[model samples]
Target: MAEKLTDSEGREDLVYIKTEDGSYRGWRVDLLIDNLSSKMEEKILLCSSCKGMLRDACFYEGDLKCGVCIPEGVAWQPVKMNREIVSDKMISCPVKKRGCEWSDTVSTVMHHLEKCEFFPVLCPLGCVCLDGERKGKVMKLERKLIPKHQRDSCPLRELVCEFCMNTVKGCEMNPHLEICEHFPLLCPNRCVIEGEEGTRQVKRRDVSVHLANECPLQKVECPYWIYGCREEMERKEMNLHEREFLHIHHRLSITDMKQKQIQMSKDNKLLEEKLDTATERIVLVEKNFESKSRELLTFKQNQIETSKQTIDKLEIATKKIAFLQNENESKIKELSKVKHMEDKLDTANIKIENLEKQISKKDSELKSIIEVLYSHISLATGQLEWKIKGVKQKIENKESSYGDPFYVGLYKCQGNIEWNYDNTGKVVVAICIVKGAYDDKLHWPIIYKYTFILLCHINSYYNYEITKQVTKEDLEKYPNSLKRPTEMRNDGLGTRSLISNTEILEAKYCKEDSITLLIKIELLPAL
Candidate 1:
């Protein structure tokens, strides 16, 4: 039977889907096997657990199970009959709806896809000339249409320049001709110079320079045009015109110079008359200056007598100012002493404010210390007892109970009572390593030994003491459990099955649904 497959769009039973290898796309199996064939007895194999189609890639022969379903430990095996059936079954082409009238077995379909005309392909030159988001992107055209795309629309398609006959890309042809030195161009003037017999073609880049200097037909003015000749001619004919009119141009230049000389003589006479008038004005100014000088001398003599009288009075006033300055200096010194005392008073106030801040900080630290003392009881030096309530209830509810984090010297830790932490059917006690305030000063990875004690409510002799030792080797082996904690706490290290549910009631370790845990930490020398 021929089965029909449809894509997401459900249009024409064919759509292009690109695979990683850029070869055959989606596998649409319209499998039709002959019932009379000997190999038709086999059926498709599937995973027993996931029910996924199984292939050779997932077949695990060592444990007789599918690799994809191995986590569930489901036993399955690939059947030889399934591979035989697949290799012999006839499947229609992937692009059958795209006018590809081809069909083959699964074994030869991969090879047939390479030559299929209806198979979709990408532009081979997209990476070379396409820009931005289109770089290296797929073209999604049939295999037969690739040639037309490359020839018509591809920017990298090679083209021959009509002017220079040079090879260039289609997109770059226009810009190339703009700067192409060998490109041919017609002369604007269309001049015909003697002894040169060729098309009046000029290169695009050199057109301006040729018109200015090399083009014989370019319009130019005569050399004597400034002297009223007013003649324009082609560049090639300029020499002949200049030779023929040499005598006439020289005559015109001589007559102009003679006229200029006559005008200069009249200008010289006018300047001499102006100089005589200026000399007469200077004589009148000197006479007035002498008269003013005599008057100024009389006024200066009178001012000198008046200055002497004013100087005597100023000398007497200067002596009185000197006495007043001495009195002002003494008053300034006294004012400075008062200002200095005021400055000392301000300095004392600043010191008093600073002392008050220090006292407040000390008081906060003392309050925290008092809280720590009330939170837990201490049996001896370096030994702390944390009272954890609701221990029995937490065990019955299968919940873990933890005491508040406390510091033992430089190390911070918490006491935990976990129910069946390791599936041991018993209550376990653990100590968590918390990030401490003094971790920076302490040696790391931390090296220490701690004694965890489960105190008996009835007698001290029945108490359970478990010692956990941490060394450099232990930190290296289990760094996450024993290293300097980077977060709030590290994984807990403790004893498993400190007391079973039955044994806990018999031993009387728990009292009134509460338990007391004592921890003694000992610091070791750093290695």
Candidate 2:
């Protein structure tokens, strides 16, 4: 079908045919179809009666046959729908086998293939041979392979020379490197020159300058060559030569020093001649000074009498100065005393400031402690459990003990189990109120109620409880006892005979040698 389709010229060569051998020939399918459509109105129209080509189509049968072949038709009417139907037919891309998956209507298929990346394209480098049999020929490559070929294989591709970093054509890189001045070459002497601290490689151009001037392996005259030591050796060996022939070098140095001394002796002789000339001039100056001294002695005799009068006036002024010095010393001593007092005042001020700072620090600490105590009291719930371990052992040993302090409302209180107190010979359990941070803020003469429970391990019903309610009358009777603590603590208020030593040992109140005490306090509104 593709082979049958022709272009406007009626040539079948426009459409490419895919053969059994998998070879494609001639123009693509879309290109051939587009060409035929442009000329189809004139070339494809046929006369229905004559079955011949029709240049003019006045009447149309499915837009394929024209009425021009019949006698009356002189104008042409185009086959519009026929071209649209042909152009709308969907077709696959010719290069779909090369990974192009595009399939579109015949009208736009050629436009899609024009921009497709999978389609084969010539080398972008447009490389052309300048010499040899292939001269003037441009290289061709697939679009996908163009980049790799231009980068690595294209002869006309621009590449940088590794030695000089100069850009050149890829084909000319070898020739450029051959003539490059910066290209590295081995030293002719093959001397083992030390490289930079970290790298073993050194620039060859720098090494060439080093070889000409400073290379230790290069031959050099001895440093003492001008001093009559004529030895030519490598610079590295010159130091060894000097050491091996030290006596000869020392003799040469002595000779050089002797020559210097001779020159210095001549200089000293010339200096001595100049000094003799100066001494002659000084003799004449001394004679002239002797005459001047005689005249000065006469003037001094005259000045002595004038000086005697001046001295008398100076002695009187000295007496006045001595008196003023004595007086100034006394005032200075007074000023020193005042300065000492001022120093003492400054020291006192410093001490006062330090004391103020210390007081401020103490106040901050007290405030923090009060806040902690208030927080504890606020969260208290007025309930506590005191467990006394080894109660039986304490009774047997006669040991008196107190528990750790705790907060009940605003009170710092403790529970104590005393074996004997004031020779009572009875076990006493008491609750004591200690001085607390919140004491000043609390109401004096405590009005809250207190409940104490002594738990029985054997039976819950056998537990003993005590309730203490302080009324207005009782507060007046025991004013000091109920008042907020002013000292370390107020005296303990619980029963003195809570349990006898013999009875407390029983299992009813004690289990596992321990007893539990539960205390709950009720807060009252401030009056």
Candidate 3:
């Protein structure tokens, strides 16, 4: 057979491939150049019929089946290499186009490529991150520079946020942190407590706790203070102090409101008495004026016969009429004065109505506060049961994979469970704080932080417990900090389970193919 010389395109990026009927051909640099070995080419590829290497296509068999495999007739199936042909022949490095000068054998070329600083490979993090077609995505880099390329330089490198607990891509870290509400911030309320007492810088997330529970100088009004009670104190002592003086405040409010109402009633009665007297006096004077007018009319009729008598009587009647008018004018002035008092009484009545509304509002609030205080007292004394049930069923749904969490509970301290979040078959449990209606009972964002204890309940006191502190950052994320909240936080605070599948499978932790976990949230006392 004749030798086929160099490639027609004159490209150096080529490899050799043996075609059927015993002829050599050229291929591209996409695959390994040393896929076949001259020392034992048959080991790389052999015929199924004759156990020979694939040759020329002119003596072709159907498909890739070699004509020589059957020697003369037809071939059924294509053949494969009997075994791998380990190459040792010399070849230039594949990165020759990139100004690499070192040459080596086929087997060792891979080693050089692996170590070459200039040799390009796909970016380790596969970041196609740039403008146009590559906006914060994957790309390619050098082999030796992968460490630096994938560290902070990689656009897709996972970066832990400095301000918050979230993990984001390096390229997005700055923008994300700019808007991350949970990012640590200096307390804006710091200026309020400054110089007075117990003032200092506080992280933004912790500001709620600091103002609500920590800073002793932070003044808080008594819940009943709006109702005429004037007690003021720090937030830490608000509950206990208010608890002590609540009844006194309520009594004072009630008494003051009742007194104001009684005084208003008396004033109205007195004003009415004066107005009626003025009215009666004006009516009597009016009647007397009418009688005098009638008498004057009668005298005028009698004096019509004599001119002099008529003149005298007319003068007297005119004087008397004028006098009666003056008396009526005085009585009318008194009536006008009574009318002014009645206007004032109307204003007073309006004020009394407003006061009654306020009293009603305060009364409703006080009742709620009492109910909450009782409940809180029961909880503190360990009289109320704060445990969760039906955990196994909640976690049993296989659809609850990583990143998705399920919540159980209608209000504050809701339990959240995510099964196999880490692909380790370990369930993650979280406690969520939803805004509740017990505003008068609990401080905003739950200033009394909680310690969540999750128990497998092996027997009684000896069961295993996974404990986590409900942090200020967690609270601030979904805080109903203003007072009563109407919604829960979007995310729950929790950890991947410390106990694994082995523990959950054990009878000590699991019973009846189900597990019952005892969960409790204890308030961390004020510091």
Candidate 4:
């Protein structure tokens, strides 16, 4: 369907008819017209008959196709047209004046304005000049201004004076001159001398008057000034017409000597006071020495008395040892008897054991014979009775053989000879003396022999069997044992256990130069 209309001004309007078969035949009254003033290029209308591209065509049907493209023989109808305005300004570029042919919509034109090269650039110092020449000059002026401003504003600038080596600023020079030490001033006196005519300022106010009397250029009225009277003169020349002349320096020397004598008298009084103080200190030192000497003498007397008491105790101990030695001798004799009895008992026990073994062998043989003969007899009873009798006799023989009569007798006498003379004390000293004599002898064998004797005696007295054997290899492994006896004795004496039996046995001792009584005990093992 298509539609057509006319503007209010009534321009030419056309309405093409479209059939119900969807084809345009020709202009018909059924077509609706809309906006007849609108341009043909801006409006589209479909051909009812051919449905092809149409020019000079208005609304032909209700459809939006071209009028020429529609086919014929379709039923026709018309619809009112709706038109929309299109603006020319929407498709043109804003920079078209600068030869930019590009076109865009209004929204796209605003985005291009941000990055456009035609936008103005400003200087960093807030200057408006974008020209290169003026920008460089402005930057140079900023750099020069910074340092000049800093120097003028800094507070610690140095100031110095050109003369007199004193520091004065431009404002402080006036006050310094009034009190200046190096300032020159004219002399007040009108008197003139030979070489100091115009400038003879007095250095001391008190001595200025003396300079008038001692002026060297003063004229003398006698020959002392003209004919060389031979006087060292420094005095006012009086007009006296005389021949005598005297030296001025002689009088000044006499006055100076008298002042020095007055100063010496005051110094002498201070020296006398210092001498008295030194004498008092010397007297105090003497008194201190006397007190210290008396205290030293008392300390020495106490040390002597302590030494005497120690000597008396040592003497008493020596006498007690002598008594013990006498008692030890008697016990040694009894030990020899006990050793003899032990040997005899050991032999008897061996013989008795052999006899019991023989008796057991004979009993076994007899029982075997009886068993062979009693195969048919009721021999169990008779055999039991014989066996019982043999068992009883064997038990009686075992009791008799095992009985230790000698041991019982020895045990009874054991208490009486309990203090056996352990010649260990003497033996250890003798072995050490022998080792010292030979010098090269390894004394391990002597030590092992003594240990064996001690262990054997202990085992014998206690009736205990020693199962472990001490070998020569064991003695060699511990070779330091050779000197252990002497070390033990010294340690014992130092601990005040010199009379102990075990300590005496353990000590290693030596004789000194054929003197057996002066024994030397070694306190360390020989390496």
Most accurate candidate by lDDT:
1
lDDT of 1 by residue, 123-204 (tens): 7775242443334555456788889988997777899987778899978988998778888778888755567886588778
- Candidate achieving higher lDDT, 1 or 2: 1
Backbone clash tally (model 2): 2
Cα lDDT tens digits, model 3, 1-527, are 22222222334333334334553332222334444545355323433343333332222433233343334454443232221232344456555565667665544654676688766567866678466433564565656678887875887799888767789998898889767766655444444453556436666567788777667667888777667777787666877886788779779889989999999999999999999999999999999999999999999977775887778899999999999999998999899999999999999999999999999999999887777664555334111123433446545553332212222122254556676565777867655555545444554444333333434556666566665554667555644432345555434556676566556667666666555555555554322
Cα lDDT for residue 60, model 3? 41
Q: Give TM-scores for every candidate, taking all chains together and pairing residue i with residue i.
A: 0.42, 0.29, 0.27, 0.16
The list of candidate 4 runs beyond 4 A from truth reads 1-268, 311-527
Cα lDDT tens digits for candidate 2, 1-527: 22222232334432334334442323333433233345544345334554433323335444444342333434545556544544564566656555667777756755775587665555667787566434686754446777798888998899988888889999898888767777776555556657634223335566668667766667788878888999899867877898999999899989999999999999999999999999999999999999999999999999999999999999999999999999998999899999999999999999999999999999989878877766556434366788889876777677867777877777677766678556666877666678886786555666566777888888889888877766777566666667778788776666676666777667788878888888777756543
Clashes of 1: 0
**Best TM-score goes to which candidate?**
1
Worst 10 residues of 4 by lDDT: 409-418
TM-score of 1: 0.42
What order do you get sorting by lDDT, best first?
1, 2, 3, 4
Query: Model 1 segments beyond 4 Å from truth?
Result: 1-88, 91-104, 107-120, 126-153, 157-169, 175-182, 191-196, 262-310, 321-527
Model 3 regions lying over 4 Å from their true place = 1-90, 97-99, 106-115, 132-137, 162-172, 175-182, 189-201, 207-527
Cα error of candidate 4 at position 317, Å: 8.6
